[model samples]
Target: MTRDLLSPAHTGCLQDFSSRYTRTCRLDAEQVQSLLYVLGTTLKANLNRSAPPKTKYFSVKCTDNVQYIISPLPQASSYLSPVRLKDNSVLLITMKEASTQENDNKLSVWYYAANKKVLDKAILHLTAVDISLDVDADRDGFVEKNNPNKNAWKWGPRGHGAVVLVNCDSETLYRRKPDYKRERILKSSDVKDMSPMVLRTKGPPKLPEGYKLVLHISQSDGENIRVFITSGERYPLVLNSEVLSKEIPYLGTDEIMFYVEGVSFPDKDFDGLVHINLSLLEPIGEGIPETPIFTDTVVFRVAPWIMTPNTLEPVEVFVCSTKDNYKFLSSMQSLVDRCGYKLNICYEYMNRGDRWMQDELEFGYIDSPHHSFPVVLDSPRNGKLDDFPYDVLLGPDFGYVTRVPSRKDVSSLDSFGNLEVSPPVTVNGKHYPLGRIIIGVAFPTASKGRNMTKMVQNFLWAQTVQEPIALYSDWLEVGHVDEFMSFVPAKDRKGFRLLLASPDAGYKLFKNLQNDGHGDAMLFEEIPDQDSISVNEILDDKQLQAENNYVQSCIDWNRDVLKRELGLDDEDIIDLPILFKLLEYRGQYRAAAYYPDMVNLIVLGRNLGIPKPFGPQVNGVCALEQEMVSLMGNLGLTCTFIDDFASYHKLLGEVHCGSNVRRAPFDFKWWNIEM
Candidate 1:
């Protein structure tokens, strides 16, 4: 719509009534610049008398749907009277309503000087067209027309904007590949995993000649997301179709749909909010390209992958069955069967004998109001079982995502065993509904120390919902966070305990045994295949004691960091009796667990799978196992010990390293969390 320029009160007409002119225009209901605006400016210029034009004024007369705007609005507020016009000013007009039929509305304007009044008169025959582009901007299943909040996103129940899911899941089990890896849709079922966007138009059942609609995304968005359109005939938007940005002709239909799929997850460089634009392009002719007359935009945010904490219910547990792990597998089977959760066993053929299940991948899920699915994060630490996550886990409703780094950048720190998530906690007033992520890295000053690659770290940090915190683990030979600490659910307080391995506790336990005439008692006494050492010999080794002291200092450093980051007090933590032995490597020494690392245990609701630390017998029972039971009993947890000594303990990994769990997603939707 154009503003009606009114002239100063005039006494007489300057031009003859014979100066009448008429024109026709096609006006878009949502156009930013109206057709009448051009008509008004051209009408004044053609008068051919600039000096006399300094005295021209104009007024408009039209129906309720037509509005004429005037600057320094006329005091009379009535178009019946002439309003003054300033030099170098423009005459503008606008259509307020979408006409039901062609030329169903009319508008008229008169130009006058003083009271010579009418200098020139123009009549416009108008055809109004309506264009509405939409998406599930409110996150509801159905698309609503041009929502006011579509252009932006907000929070809370009143917030709006569509939620997009990263199409990382593999729909085809036969030839496995992530659905988003392809530029075009491969299966109809894949469509269900993406968000829907639509373009709707109505007016005269056809658009004006040379006018068209176009859908486009920003260059940055092209790398993160893709949009697909569906056409009924001729050129059906199908396989190998391009979706970056293209002209979409008016098909004389009321609606056209486009599906938005996230091809990449959020990262440090991307905040996850993406915009898709629809424009109505008008042909300017003379071999020139069309210009957009009106643009409608909607925003979408890629849903972050959320990590489930141990506090959540477990649905399934995954572990590999190698020839040497029969006893470990038997113990795991008993524990899982008793807990009533499903257990998946990867046989030698699938695993190829590699059994570090937890190091190969981490389990998490991405969610939206429209859909949700579990996504396995594959690690860069490619082991013999590297194919397990993609081959067996990437099925319908299941997804697989990974980050690859140069092999030189990969180390033991790159393993998923270094990855863990804490239970929900409130630090100050902020709450982490899904808890925060925990990963191992080198101490800041260790120039040559091993650390998780930046690619994986950025991906984890980009998740946003579970902000990740790095803990120093390079002091340990394996460089995995799980080797020294883990979380277990509790019935009270913070709802979980931060179990840490403590060498101090280990020495205290050994001293008590030596004082009770158990100095002759030996460690690993039951295992005939291994050498045993008496408790007195361990107490007398000053070198071993010094090594443990150094290990304690390292564990202490991380304990303080976790306390401050997780908002924990001493009572929120549990110190387990565990020891470490130092190994020399290239003129430097690193600590490794001397016994099965008991802190590296799997939590399954009330039941726990702990490594059986085979310490010397105390009154016909393993004193180390009894100590664990006594400490865990106060929290009402049942500790079931699994013997992984010969199989995994000697290999420097523990039960948690050999097993993985897929827990149920939180009942609380992630969208509600404060970002």
Candidate 2:
């Protein structure tokens, strides 16, 4: 029977049995022979007792329903018998009686060790099913379980049978077979963990008041990390931490933290967000990758304290009151009243021949008053003068009375007979050492070569103070820094903006007027009939070429120096179109004068006081005044035009020199500021 079952002629039968069982079963020839012998003996015994004398062989019919239901049970089942083969090996076979409902109709063909100790050490391989096994080692009531999610098989208290079962859902069994194979492959492969995690941060949404802002960073084990805050390109605030000495903080581990310090609200109202950036750098010797290792930005909203300008003490306007300037006093007084500012009229009188009350000579210049004064919260000089000294005066005859409070003290003179001492000027309740600041001087040819020794000494003195004085061309009769450049509060309220006189724009206006045939009128209208000359007579082509070259050189030099000193860009400057005229001074030497001196306008807080240009109208318009007013309006400034043609402009002076401002003290401590 074993030979017949193993023959090629019975291959179809074997396949049919396997199909019905729905599982593959491997059997040795000995096990097949035993099964056949048991069936044969039982059939012969039953047939002999029931059949008549003619019944030599018994016939059996296999029904499809019975065949399908009578499938093999697991080898560990109690009904399975162990056959000891002639080779001394045991073959476990499930009997037909083992196919019962209690078995869950599951065919468990895999074998297991009967001994509890042997079964405990045995390995059971499975794909997706979570498996478990239990053994009663001492025949005790307690059964030890393993792999709890898998089916459990209970051995009798005597530890008679050892069972193994694999349980899993149909979907998991089908899906996880490939995954299990891949996991085996992965475990065998030698691969390094090269991918590092990104840096992350957890912190408060808003910064706390009067306390350091703390932030926690997720652990970055091996990479170098850096963090900082930025407001575009301007470096204003400081970022400090134990790990950093500069703006960028470097960290070896994420456990360390950093903070921002010296952060203050802007002078004006500002509500916005600032970005904090975290950067991670790859380990050294790791070549540059296609992209940066890691970069992340976190935004935080800021609400800073609000402050208003001090109103108890307002800015003051100072003007020289030489005898000739007395006529314009009423207009100045009216302007002060309208703008709600205090007016200080310096009445010190001085005579320097015919040009004594010239605006450039008398007014004097103050560049940055904030840096010059000492701040005090409460005092008579809360924002005003501290002390006035006489020996420190700049000059004697050069002093217009409004400039000098003491006349009896004569200061030592330089080679050109110019006073050499630096004076103390009072503004906003504080006194500044004028000697320490570099003063801009414009010495005419008469004063230049006449006293080279004294001039060099003055220059050395200026250098010794670490403030190299700026010396512009003195071609103009009233050449002065105030005549061409003035400082106005910036729109952002951070600092002041420099207002420059744009000669290029002025030349364009002149060209336009000339093309329209109004050039002669602009040149001759201001002069008397006897003295009037045509534009051509005043400046031939050769003279005009020289003048253009001179003006361009002056403009370029001034612009470059101002930008270097003030750290200004083009955006920080406002250019006002202003034309210059060549004129004979005392019929001996030639001099230049700005036709309108637009930059010479006065600033009173947010308001401006400008001079109304008085000259020939071009194309039915006073182009200078029209342009100045239009530009001021566009700048968001309220302007008041005061007529200074007869009083100031005719004397080679303009509005700024005729008046000054003791601007309001800023709320911030200037001394604490880093330059």
Candidate 3:
């Protein structure tokens, strides 16, 4: 700061040259080594506060090691040019010669007073530091130096931003909690999940007495993320709130490495983008608090969890072996073996008689440039299988996530069977390379029907990769979308087909059987407890026909929704011959499978595990099986009828409802999609 001296006799204002105070400036080593360095800047502040200073002539005087630097001149002028300091001007200086080691430097200047006869000089102190903050914002796998846009995010192939993976995967099975839930990294693999940040500093072995560098995160970001600095044995967590920040002394010749791990996922509450900052604080006065002279920043966005569809490659199939489902388990084992995929069976000990494995969890995986792994999305429906995912499936590279709403909101619609995904689709020119998620909810106009819990829906919607579309499933007694609709692989036309259970198809198949003189072929003729009904008897039941008409209307409403939302054509659908019967639930009528729901089947590669539909036997084989084979035969699919008649269908579910599958993730990278 400079002050003026004015007297009536002199009638002139005091200029900065009249002051004896010295100006000291510090430049980083990188800046000093450049062709030109900005030593200081001058600008007009407020005209109302103070008048602008007049341009003053100046002469530079400095040590031999450093000199006033300027842009290269034209060939016409090689002589030293006169220097002047004015409003909105930059004083450029640089090292006289390049040097690898630290250099003690100084620069001085003399300026003429208003009298034009007197001269005064001021000393300018100079120093250089090797402080460079770096991050992989460009995603080129190498840390870039001091980029101005490091703290911002950009999308697409040419964008720039660091990536952070949700530390959702586990590295150890000995621990009961997930790896993300642990306070510290459990193994070397856990460290691989974080983004690398480097603070490269080189100077004297120690910083000047009162200078230090501190790393920190904002308070809001601190809650959803954690940062660690690599030391000897332990990577000390810096953003642990107890300290909230960590100070790095002069690294001398070493670099400080920091790893950022996302503790929370992208949801309604968190936006998925996080920031980490580094500041250089300087000591001004002995007792004065240090001031932050320089700051650097880097940003990251948590990767969204992605769901795999049935059309993708199958990794494995999971089913619970209950007390009454032995026949179903055997059928599933044969189907899995024939398909050449692994089978994971949860026996009675852990399942505790809860047979609906599809209701318990959905399989998804989070991904980033650093790492990716399968993360099981546990549903709010807390059946006896609640502990199965957390206890068994969570180990090594596997991850776990769950949303538990209030018990009052929990319903059958909250089950994972209510959750499904279409194959990759392009709706309205917008492509979904990973496919879109499907969920069951009450009809939009209905006020008293059941819907999937809001908390679970929020969690699913936050996974922006595969945006979800809701279908009406409250018409069914169990309120699951899978009870009426599914997806399977196909050779052509979008690579998959939307399968829907059609009561019209069921009646048409039966009428053909009756016309073929198979009317006496009884439905449930020899089945254990079902009363036999002739095809003619079924055709004469006007009330049954009326209920089926109502059920067909419900199915058609969803059929239109699926066609519109998934960009499906009429040719893309396969209507299976399955019928539903309405029953009184509470005060409203909801439909349940009249026989085994053939559409609620598991699709593994080209193999299908359909629930055995106990229909009228016109020949040695069941007519329903023959009809299903005919429908799927054109697609080069094989049908394996799983006899879940008493174990699953009688209990108001079918094959897909009781079994779950974990398929391989898409080969496409999720981050490349334009959001």
Candidate 4:
């Protein structure tokens, strides 16, 4: 043995024993026996029989007349295959080299004092455990540093690193792995099968229409669970989990409570398909000690509040009442509240014979913008009152307003009378510039013992004009303004459009003529001649029974059929039938009205028949109940009957808001439809 084996400078690769080489390398059974025999003989001939030498052990054997020791030559396993091996040549040679005791360390060294033949046999048993030709430490450090994509030696229970040791393979090095993706989190969440995840004794009874689920996480304390939703967005939510958590702990408390809101999306993807997915983020188990696990997998979409054309806006609408018809007013108020908008209502005085009262009443009572609700309110200008009662007929005005005066009145002077007097206008107790006062008259109060049918005719007259303005004699006594009124411009009064019905055939006509192609005919009130018509005439025996059946069917659709099938409550299913019947009724009116005037409009406008300008309104109306059910089947939908413009706006707002999520003020555009 020599000191070279222990020298750090003479390093060689013997780290991994299994991967590089195995137990059997160079000799057969007979060859090994013969080599061992010859090497034993040589050791006896060279060294003293009684004296033994001290050196690093390689492989040694002593027999009857011979002593043998096998030494790894400097070449060792590094020797490349020679052109050929001579017979009994020393591939596994046994050699007896002298030993130096200066450095006897852990490194394996060769033994001296052995015959070549005997040493060869001992070396044959020295199987190549780990034989590498590197001969240097740095050359075989880590394989991971060179190849990133390859799997490194990992220490986990399921990987190869578990079975391998550090010294086994010197070339392999370990690296980090990626995070696991299992589930997702939603912005606007949906609990499709909520029963399993949370304690849903009744499963929240399916979310109602125009309502959405907003997530509110609470810590064990009364405070909300604060988290940064956006990396840089400044706005943070201050949720009161007390309302959402109820019996549960605060967000990230002992357990975080998730408050979910119901919502839906239409055409959310490039394929024009509607879909829902969860909102997700890599949650850090920082504040909470334990690993946070979602008890329920929610279906949520990002709901961004924005100020766009589609985004909701609040408006205060003024409505008048006569003869204690507060039902209409109350209904309208509820509608506005439900639609998620603000409404302002105020009653005013109208002529006994004037058609303004009823028109105002209907305007005040709009189920939806599609269905006319005439309401009158004083317009506000620059934080000041413009007039006491300037009529504003608003709804889904497809385009512009067209006003036509029907007749004249002797007592009329408001247009000039009100303007002539300089009244101090005060809004919030502040005086402002005075403008021309216009006397807005809502004719024919359904109350006040006036004919309801005649009231509708007045509204009809106002809607049927093509020009921006019109003047006419009160041949029908529709309004006294017809007499003195002239040069009144059309103001796009969609609010004034009312669904009128006569006692005789009004209901049938109104129901049938909903989306008729004839603008003029459609403009005619269902109860065109109220004096001669009766409710009995319109819904006579058989017709009344049919209406009853239709109503019953609608009720069933909402209660029995819809609720049971969709797993909705009674109230949620109730509104669908009412709207459906209303649709049926309106459809009939439209069909009946179209035949007479359809030809004329089709001939005149040529390409532009009875303009389908009512697309949004009509779409909104059609989407009323059934559309909601179809849209949000998993979440239930039902309607609350809207009575006036205020409620109608609210409903419209809620509907629009509930349909899709709006991003930031500038993030989204009409062209961009993200769910």
Candidate 5:
């Protein structure tokens, strides 16, 4: 007969119903119960072995009537019955005494002992130590020693060996005396007893209203600690506690007000007298507030008194800001110029919004009001708002707003306008209000010499300003200055320089300077402001395009005269076109580096193709073009001169009269012109 352990659902069944003697098994109440008990125990054992391991702790109950079943049970089951066997270590935290005036005035110490007997012996030695005999012991310094046991004092050696002590002065000591004096301090007592305290006062303990006092106890050392607090005071009462000292509230004045006190238990060294002065509390709070309670958190750490002595010279300039913008506005040069007084700025990065600034204006009453940017003045007396002038040199009528997309072909005239060629003192496309006309100049290429200068003058004259003339140049493209470079020169010229290798309009200007022995005037470099990054490349491209266009315009103008007015013919026009092409494309790429002598060849080889207007004329045209290009290059000027505007205008008129109407401003039909 084999026993099967795995099968729970299968059981022995009656086979061949008519086998009377073979079915000798008992089916009575006691037999059934006994068999079930055995089966249940065996099944439970097997199931327990097969079940996977559980990681958490659990409570289990076993009963004789209850069969082994994996199912939920009620809470009142026998499993929940209490059965204690082993004892565990316990910690006792006790408050020994409240902090009264006597305790508050003294330095306190708490001692730990294993048992009452050890504590008694320690107390006896401590009481007899004669702490005064120690070197440098202050007779006046207050000192108090406390132990856990109340009965241990009786066993302590009296007179000389008493362990517990108390005092009400400064620098009191607790010393351990020599063995010879131990007997003298110790009392010969057969049983335990108690003693008393020295210098008893006549008054009862006094505490402020709403303060529930308690003595804190250290678990490991059994040291007792205590501190008192009023209703609103949240002081640190625990030793070695983490303490955070908060700022006191300001009472609405330049003299800031804040209270000092500890507010935690873990830090023990938080006791110090804070003088509570304005300068010391400068960095304490956030900016001003709308309501008294809406001020910023006034928490800060103050160094020792020596670090901020009372005799320290008061700063002339009172620095303050409601917004966080002034955080990085502390450069020494800016400080001297912007703030009239010495550096006395409160460095608190409080984000209180508009109300902060409003409060500053009310409380600080600074002469100049600073919102997003500082309102700096040339002098302290000039801080009056009226002293500074509005940036309206261009005047009202002359102003125009146009969103000129940054283009390679056009230089942005100003933040709000675009430029077209014009002359000086043209008032709004009408009259010439020739007062002192101030013209502003800005460009990526500073070496443009008199060309840009004259161009700016031309733009101003086209605007027609009726004021005295004041010409300004932005030498530096500072971020803000880049937008208003044409209007104000004082703030923008710091970084201005004539970049020789700028590869823009400056290229032509640089060449001119090199030819004229004034190249040194244009060569300069400086770090550009970060905010001007967008305009940097855009302006550079514009400058390059303008330079190229100027060159082409000059060549086209000269060619027109040489062909039509001077009657030079088609060969002459072709040759001039070649010259312009050579001048523009000669040093374009790696080819120039290889063929360095090509410039000289082109200069000497240039000659007209033929005198005929439409005949075969490649050689003469190519030769003439080379000569003209080389000659132009040697001059170091990109043919920007507008010598005959009137003649050009007349020729355009004749062309327009005979030409067909076209959609584009410049587009026209040659047939129409001929007709």
Candidate 6:
């Protein structure tokens, strides 16, 4: 009866055989012999081998009284295929149903050699017992369960169950047959004992938000163990692992540690798990090694920060205007109207007698024409001028909301009112007040001996409070943080996201324009001042190349410092394509021409005000302005373009320097919160 059951039947496809053999079929001597002959012939044909088999073949009857036979088909079999273990050992794999006598109907994998002999077998331990393996059991064309759109199947252990091959000499088997290569499996005893353990460090059960959490791994017996960390939550947690080594000269042994830094969670009450995976690799031979994996998880809750940007409210905005800025102001008013007239706009007139106005100098340093004007926060209102407070002076330039004003107080003053100023401190060859942070540009003209003391003093005075200052490249004439980056409230009302000018995107657009033969024409048409000069004369190819390099380096440095200070990731950044022009400024040197100023935008609540693109029109619309508006719309922001090409861009200023925001006062007191 067994021989008759095991006899070869003409199945049209391999799927028929896989579906039919759900139960074990006991084989007789004649059936086993016939299977072995067929397997040897198939192996020889597939391997292109002409030599006769030298090894003996045999069958093994499992404890459940089910006889197992390994054989190869004339064609490639989807149900039965050869797989190489990690140790470079080849095994013929097949799925067999659990015995009727056993209560558990678990998956059982049988391993055999090409010579039709059973080497080893084991029952897989499955945590997810509900997994269905009826389809793609061989994993030839299996699509990932998580990703349905993917066409190619991911190659690995596909099912939910885990298998542990027992009583197999992986090294000797690979040595005998050098052609075989496959993924390796661990022993059943080792697999059962594998469980990752987390070592404790100095910290409470709940960690404060934006604080770093250092974790140490307990010493284990294995020499070649690799650990990996991953967060299962949406909160951004940075992970850094120390190099694992067995040689420590000081301790004379291996020491390993993993550092996990917790950032400000998007939500205040975030509690989640961090998973750690440990893999122990064992070398089988000169080929690949076998690994046994263990997983462990840690629970942590993040405490909210003292104060965040969420408490901010809308307030009055300030802009400087002169007789030359009427057109620009008109355009700005139009934009404000388009934004539903939500913003409270105020104007400060510039002093016409200021000597700096005659030449292209630092217009930012010019005082307001009105003596009693509230230019710097917390300044004296008596019209008699003294040195401005360091914090208040720094606050306006950097646009930092240092302190909130009281409703009763007529003048907007900070907490440190009428306090005597302290002397600046010099650290690492740079002069700065104690706990004061200020960002500035490093000009190439500043000498080591001279040290640009006045510029440094001005920067120190402008800082509203002690904060971590991030310095960016200042190769451009009007180089400022506002030129390249802007912080806007997130649409989710959680925090702020940085909007950056992407040089990579701009370069690609410019290259496309150059290829289309409009590069020279566009430059000449945009810069109408240089009517006699050709595009080649206006733009030096060498300088343009150097400017791009500097821009990229500056962007990289700013990104790194911002990530550290603001706890921001790449996903939190919004990049816009804004290119710069290398134009000859004065008769001696070349400077960056920042015309579009898309990133140098004004934020009025949820709406953003930007400068119109300063260039030729493409199909009745400015190309750069259209791109900027489209990008802003994609980010869920309402964009209004203000034409400032003649009044502001020509003077090497943009919407940011021309205007400032006096944001709404929040209830949070800076003095009450810990820095």
Which stretches of model 1 miss by more than 4 angstroms? Answer: 1-55, 77-79, 88-96, 155-158, 232-243, 251-253
Candidate number that wins on TM-score, 3 or 4: 3
Write the residue-wise lDDT of candidate 5 on 508-610 in tens digits: 5334434655333311011122122111232245544454454344334434432332223332221221111112223321001000111111000111011
Q: In angstroms, give how far residue 449 of model 4 lies from its true place.
A: 43
Clashing pairs counted in every model: 24, 10, 0, 78, 54, 12
Backbone clashes (count) for model 2 = 10
Q: lDDT (CA) for every model shown?
A: 0.79, 0.35, 0.76, 0.21, 0.19, 0.35
Residue 136 miss distance in model 6 (angstroms)? 72
Better of 4 and 5 by lDDT: 4
- Clash pairs detected, candidate 3: none
As a TM-score, model 2 comes out at: 0.38
Which candidate number maximizes TM-score?
1
Judged by whole-model lDDT over C-alpha atoms, candidate 5 comes out at 0.19
Alpha-carbon shift of residue 77 in model 4 (angstroms): 28
Candidate 4 residues 582-653, lDDT tens each? Answer: 213322310111111110111000011111111112323421223223422333222342222222111211
Better of 3 and 6 by lDDT: 3
Candidate 6 structure quality by residue, lDDT tens digits, 1-675: 111112122222233233211322122212121111110011111111211233222222223212222343222332243332222121122223322221222223444456656554434221110111111112222312212211122212342211111111122222221010112222222111111222322112221222222222323211112222322322121222234321111111122222222221112122111222232222334555432221112321111111112113434444445656777677666766665544333322323311111011111111111110112322222211211222222221221111222333312111111111111223344432222232334444534211112322333333222343534434445445556676666555224567777766666655555566645535325544644322333244666656766676667677776655554567777777665655555642324444556776777767777877654354555556677777667667677777777677776656755665444333322122232
Quote the lDDT for 103 in model 2. 16
TM-score-superior candidate, 3 or 5? 3
In candidate 3, what residue range of length 10 has the lowest lDDT sum? 41-50
Instruction: Name the runs in model 6 displaced over 4 angstroms.
Output: 1-312, 340-350, 353-375, 378-438, 441-466, 492-494, 513-542, 581-591
lDDT of 2 by residue, 1-675 (tens): 121111121223333332111221233211211111110001111112222223222222221211111112212332233211112121211122211121122212222233211111111111111111122212222233321211222222322211111100011222332111111112111111000112222222211122121222322200112233332332222222223323233221222222221121111222222333443322233353322223333332221111112111336665656546554677778878887888865555322222222222212211111111211111111111211111112221111111221222211111111111122222333332222122234443445421212333332342221223354535455445556666555455324466777767666665666677766745435434324434344334556546655665676677786665544577767777665656765653433444547677777766777766544466666666677767767667777766665567777767764664433433432222221
- Would you list the rank order by TM-score, best first? 1, 3, 6, 2, 4, 5
Error of 2 at 295 (Å): 56
lDDT of 2 at 64: 22
RMSD of 3: 7.4
